[model samples]
Target: MSKSKRLMELMMTVNRMRKFTVRQLADQFDVSPRTILRDLQELSELGVPLYSEVGPHGGYQVLKERILPPIAFSEEEAVAMFFASHALRHYLFLPFEAESSTALQKFYYYMPGDVRDRIDQMKNRVDFLTHTRQQKAEYLGVLLEASVDQRVVTMQYETKNGYSERTIQPVGIYASNGFWYCPAYCFLRRDFRLFRCDRMQSVANDSTGIEPLDHRHIHLGNWEEHGSEKPVYIRMIVDLSREGVRRCESELWHVPHMDITPDGSGQLNQNVPSSELMYFAKFFIGLGNEATVKEPSELVECMKGILNEIMAKYD
Candidate 1:
């Protein structure tokens, strides 16, 4: 590595560990103590805020709260960061757009010449889909903060049936289909619920005096898939046609056991609790009439109701 690069790496090591003697640094970098001291002096002169302490435990340390200069990135590193930021820019609809653009510009400007040349050569070959429009950025920011802080929020949510005011403690934010969703514990229903971020008419941080629930008590993903209800096994018979086999193999649905006969006819046996049966039903709706629930009277009724609704639409 170049002297500047080696010095930058040493600076990072020292910053993370909080203290390192010149001898220790020399050993780490495989250099002489004199070279380590010279590098430290150069770094200090470059506004790195490195200080040396004297005594039994004395070593060089970057003072806390000091902002270090940006490290140089290789051409590959620059391109990778750019691509990551580009992907986020497309998927994330938030106030981060300007920040992402500025960071990308600064990265490209500081990158070494050879690295920059490689990035330029590959730039045209890398492109992402741009058809999707940007979403409200502030909503995402608020949802993220709520999830991290474990704070409750009050929002007016628009469901397919109608609108309702709700107070919920957000557990996490996830993307499904093309929209963002906040899975939270709803106060009104006294259960976990998923709220579409965009469909939220109004959202505000709630500071009212209510004891925050312990997040560890809830299974957020399972709650989102199947409410707080206990799971019950539901059996499904999936046809083993080419399309059916491929569909069952998809990660989107969880099928525990599937048996295929010599004739290509297959039985897909899934042990889904009542909690996730609705999700399974919604997923299988795309299979037309080929996917059938053979057992669990409740699930059969649910599927029949859904099919009835679809048939009604045609009638």
Candidate 2:
């Protein structure tokens, strides 16, 4: 095999075995012990973090490091990451665009010549669907940095009513529906909240030495789970005749609890906040009478109001 391919195989061996003696690696790669040691030294210089121990059981191992040297990607792998990153550039908006671009540049630069050429050709041939214009901002990165550093920040937030200043202890950054959101504990509100990064006007580090809040209350995966004092039970009845029973059985909507009555009536039970319950109600609006909110009089009223609004639009 060529030296590059041999080196790639050696790296894979080192990663998989965790520790391998020079003799063992030499035997596996069908090379001399001297050559194996040389290869390990080369990888170490390239930032592979391969370390050797001396004794009877001594072998080489890779030390865990936060930042390691880049790995060799096949032509297909390079193109896949490039396309994925390219698609993310549109949705991530501000800070991620520059960051992903820089990372992609580094990836391209380090790729083998043939793979790099193939990626460049693919990039020239592929075109992404252009997105609508968006307001440019940089606070996403700032919030991300603060979250990673576990630092407190004071920022001006724009809410539906108006702008308000807040002191927040940021816990994590998340993305939902093509927008960036920071889940943090707001000192002003004295509760955990999700804030849209695009709506933030200004952010500055506050060195007031505020303790990091417990993140147990933060459910970064689902925003609906946060900001609720009482869990509201929402039940829905879906007609299998109009809506395919197969789709409901597929669990597309992520309903946690559900039941089917003997008479073929489907019941969905979920403990969600009022806002999330209403948000989900809109999804069944076009189903007409085929979908119905069965419980929580408030949700039934909300769905009725939505149906009324739709009727008004038609009128």
Candidate 3:
């Protein structure tokens, strides 16, 4: 085989084997050990993370972060991939922020000149807008890993009341409106709670020896089915004007329950958690006259109390 072909095959072979001796590769490729060693050296230079050991049991091993084999992409596919990563630029924090940046750099710089030019032109046209929140989710990586590993974590969480330490086993972490949220089972409340990632002051492994909950069945996509809060929900209905419908569409959680009329009027009818009625009150208040609560007396009272407080402030 040509030297290039041999190197490519060697890359794939070592990645698949993960742990193999120089002699093993040499025998498999029908090449001398010295030639295989030279090829391995070149692969290391090419950014393939390789670790070598000289003991009897130790040999060449790929590190935890393995380099993936190259795949050819069509021009259209390349553009799509570039835009997908580019869209994440709106968020200030990402679970894989550094890796995402480096990947985008590699993808852009390595593309053909024409493709790069096309991407440059398209950059001004298309965008994925997010709220661009100021708060940082510094513990996103740790929370994500704990969720995947089913490990319990203790965190100092700040709430409206104050800061407190709690043990939680996260189901998953998701980014919405430029902020990260972790839905986890909170041992303190003995229930599932949606935690704002920025509110977590510090996170660490649970030293209380609390067993982790099996949240494998719960995911961001289906946590609603489990319950907004212990399967308890209060029916909430709201009437919306055309402007309201447009405004509510920007909120991902409210879109599913919004029904629009041909005349641009709409209604939001959904079961919302009773504990969050105050939140709904604030949201509708922000809409001013565009939205009106039609049902749920508690929500109406909550809104009334808030408006009364504002009126009192003026008085």
Q: How much is the lDDT of residue 231 in candidate 2?
A: 57
Clashes counted in candidate 1 amount to: 3
Better of 1 and 3 by TM-score: 3
Give Cα-based local distance difference scores for all models.
0.71, 0.70, 0.90
Maximum-lDDT candidate: 3
Number of the predicted model whose TM-score against the real structure is largest: 3
Error of 1 at 293 (Å): 7.5
Model 1 clash pairs are 94-137, 232-273, 232-274
The TM-score of candidate 3 is 0.90
- Clashing residue pairs in candidate 2 (N, C-alpha, C atoms within 3 angstroms): none
TM-score of each: 0.59, 0.60, 0.90
**In model 3, which residue pairs have backbone atoms overlapping below 3 Å?**
none
**Superposed Cα deviation of residue 44, candidate 1 (Å):** 14
Error of 3 at 163 (Å): 2.4
Who is ahead in TM-score, 1 or 2? 2
